[model samples]
Target: MSVLPLVFTSGWASGINAYAVVLLLGVFGATGLSDDVPEVLQRPDVLIAAAVLFLCEAVADKIPYVDSVWDSVHTVIRPIAGAVVAALLAGQSGSLPELAAGAVGGTTALMSHFVKAGTRMAVNTSPEPFSNIAVSTAEDLGVAAIIIFALFHPVAAAVIAGTLLALGLAAVVFLAQRIRRFWRRRAQRRAERRPTGPGVRHPVPTDGSEHF
Candidate 1:
């Protein structure tokens, strides 16, 4: 169950499958399944599941406030996965097509990261767990939708890929400011919590002259 979610979140042909499998094995060594096979090869169901999961993740990232945290976490993961998957898919296309795919893939990754990060940052202002959960779920759904549409209609996917990139960037600028504000407030609070130097320096008063 948990493995499925992890794989789905990782994305199709993203190389994450290989890394994730190995990581799982290193941690759960030979417990039930070997960790070398590609996710798609190992489980056809994973393809569909990935599509569904991505769709949800994507939608979740688009949510108003909670999208911020989701974005922060995905920042490192989405683009690389997008590029790898695009590279893999490009193999099936012509040179020109492949280049286009790669571009789309890389862009998709960048866009996804921005949108997720920005939205989450904005959401940080509220930091409501319920809102966060809702946004997270929506992004997962969005990822799935992207996968499905991209698989069925590459051209449409390309267009959407561009749109997503734009939107993600927009979100970055929008949420960055908000996140900064949140951080500033948090820092101020921390500073306030700190103890001021020595608690009331003892009056060296009478003994001051002798100490000197």
Candidate 2:
């Protein structure tokens, strides 16, 4: 089977939650559920590491500003992970060059990562944290579901992933100005609420009688 579908699907998922994608793929491959997954990923140590990181991400991703921080830290990590996974998938399938697959995965992951990070930054402008948590949870679940779908129906999963990515990017571009305005207003409000420092004040003359 061609690995292009899994490459795109996994790359997209990795951007949102690389650890979850790794753990899901590793578990499925280890359990004889999927043969397309690489042997290295199915190793117990790899699965354990991915699981631990995923748990940490799950917690960090739910917090408002913290999720943004986490995303910032993973800006490089996710793309690299995506590339590695894509290379491994290609190796397993023997249908594509590892270099080309890696390039596709890395680029796809970078685009999706930007989308996720930008959306989260905009979400962080809001005072409420529920939206952050909800979005994070949805992303995790979406990654898991997509990986499973890719295992069974790679072409359809890839198409869906591509559609979602396009929509996400379009939405981000459409809301960029609004997001900027929202943060600007929030900052302005914060500045207005800030306490003023003590300072000497000159008294105004009344009836032109107090000029000094």
Candidate 3:
């Protein structure tokens, strides 16, 4: 069948939307492991696996506060997703490879989640309706793309998926620091810019006593 669904699923799993797939693939292929797993490149089973992961991810994202809460659970889903993907990719390759793949996939997913979660936190600080709309639209587009790509190209899809995860983690690290620095600088500047308190009227020099 089509591998597009596989690609889409992997992409979303890494916090990307289908509309942005081309850009993601370009960046991921250029800087990350865009071809480490070949099964997604040509296997139906692998493709389906990616689809399953994407589906599970979508469901996980919908439970109201569950999305952010999931982040706190940590140590739970990351390895599971990785293990599952690795196993799917491994096929007959054996358990060791499967375990390794799982580890990679899970970790990749976690990194993506971290970055996205951080972004959402930042967004929530902004005006209401707009933030909700933005987050909802983003999630919708992302889910749609994953479903589309996974059904088409499993292996290549997973490769791109992995790349997204890696890139997301990198982004979180890079941006978190930059944001912190920006705020600190802004605070410092604001403090400096603030006007000083009103000056007290001085008594005549000869008086000395009274208020100084």
Candidate 4:
């Protein structure tokens, strides 16, 4: 059904940018663009709140370590948001059961969230700053496009979102080994750089003046 496709699409986008998806949906409903969206999402206060959070995410998502922390914090939030949104849509549409929609939305959101978080971990392994910004920018754009397009063509939007989700998951799996190695090397480097306390001792120095 159209409701199912819309929920699946939104669920995928929610994993990457839940606030953005919520804000956009609220705006669409408030503007009378889509009757399928629930009034609860279109309230003035809800739109304001979603917009504020979306702005916060837009900024925090561009920084490397900050983005990872953001992702970690949203691991639970995103999936719940997806489920609530799906349930509301289903309740309004009367095409699908609320519980079924919630399950589909929440499960898809969880899977896509892991894919996103894992991909970020792998990307952060790179020393460059631009990659994080680029990835975050792309995700925001993708979420907005999918949500807007889903308003008119839910099934097509779902197909695109599903494809992207699958690609992201595959990329995460492929980079799992690299992600592990990067963390291990980083830990070793930190230990090597750690300051020696008054009671600590070291092996032969690297300086020629202090030979083995």
TM-score of 3: 0.46
Better of 1 and 2 by TM-score: 2
Question: For candidate 3, lDDT tens digit of each residue in 32-84?
Answer: 44542343433555444545655554555544344445444543554454345
**Tens-place lDDT digits, model 4, residues 1-212:** 55999999989988888899899999999999887789999999999999999999989888877787898899999999999999998999999999999999998999999998888888888889899999999889989999999999999999999999999888988999867865786588789898888977767666677844
Q: Please give, for residues 87-135, the per-residue lDDT of candidate 1 as tens digits.
A: 4444433233545555655554565555555566666677456666676
Model 3 poorest 10 in a row by lDDT: 16-25
Candidate 3, after superposition: displacement of residue 191 in Å?
24
| Model 2 agreement with the true structure over 1-212: per-residue lDDT tens digits | 78999999999999989999899999999999998989999999999999999999999999987887799899999999999999999998999999999999988898899889888877887789999999998988888899999999999999999998999899889779756865686589787887766784545777879857
Report the error of model 2 at residue 23, Å: 0.4
Better of 2 and 4 by TM-score: 4
Clashes of each: 36, 0, 29, 0
Give the Cα error of residue 141 in candidate 1, in Å.
0.9
Best by TM-score: 4
Candidate models: Cα lDDT each: 0.48, 0.90, 0.48, 0.90
- Ten residues in sequence with the least summed lDDT for candidate 1: 1-10
Residue range with the least summed lDDT across 10 consecutive positions in model 2: 194-203
Candidate 3's displacement at residue 125, Å, is 1.8
What lDDT does model 1 reach?
Answer: 0.48
lDDT: which is higher, 3 or 4? 4
